[model samples]
Target: MKRMLSLVVTTAALLLALPASAQFAKPEDAIKYRKSALTVMGTHWARLAGMAQGRIPYDAKAAADNAAVLEVAHKLPWAAFGADTQSGDTKAKSEIWKEPAKFKEAEERLFAEVPKIVAAARSGKQDDLKAAFAAGGGVCKNCHDNFRQ
Candidate 1:
């Protein structure tokens, strides 16, 4: 866990050093980056959701592991949503650019909620996990409904 956390910290620091506008060489590259990050986030999110909803048996260690990955994964795609990347192979709606404030609100909400999930998972309590999952999922779904196609 320590090694994984260290690597995540290092990667995040490196990413942060780059300007968002210069992160991608082309619009399609941004789209691909966004899609790849979202896919990774979605995969871990599904595992946590399954456990919370009882589709998959709840194991504290598994929840912790998934949530740890999610902590990093969830922050990835947002930086790729620059203006240059808006017209690519993406399902992102025009509303995202049209209503930047609203889109940003949704992103902030999700960012705020992810730590709660990490905390709940670390708690080793299924009920806590369920509550956090519901709150976090609501933020995620709201973004999909408003910004995504």
Candidate 2:
């Protein structure tokens, strides 16, 4: 019994010390923190999109839950991308600052995509949802391709 108690205490201590984002910190730990959080957001988004697209069937509660997470995480990764942070582990390019208008458009596209995904998930329809998510992802990919390395 004493041994078991010690093991349990050790496990709890370790779990408290190690956050989910621990593996993803960059040198300054900005983008890494956001991306780690974003990854959590993305996992749900992919599931809902897959279901919405018909790879899996719609699960209403799941859609709601995942949508909730994605809504926030969608906005996080961009905050860390200031002019001072133009290097290392980022998909961001110098063009982000150079062609501000185009970058803004890309950002807008992603913003637009998230709401639609949420709407579709809320509507509880599987049909055409996958395509919607893929289109949203395209916005993300477009930005990442151009800006992030």
Candidate whose TM-score is highest: 1
Candidate 2 residue runs with Cα over 4 Å from true position: 1-27, 134-137
Spell out the clash pairs found in candidate 2.
53-130, 90-149, 91-147, 91-148, 91-149, 92-147, 92-148, 93-147
Q: What are the per-residue Cα lDDT tens digits for candidate 2 across 1-149? A: 99999999998888656643443344457666656766876787788867776677677787777778888878766555555556677655789889878888887888888888877777766554666776665776787788666
lDDT of 1 by residue, 11-117 (tens): 99998988776878888998899999999999998898898899999999999999999999999999888888778689999998899999999999989988998
lDDT of 1 at 149: 88
Full-model lDDT, candidate 1: 0.90
TM-score of 1: 0.87
Off by over 4 Å in 1: 1-17
RMSD in Å for model 1: 4.9
lDDT of 1 at 72: 97
Quote the lDDT for 104 in model 2.
Answer: 81
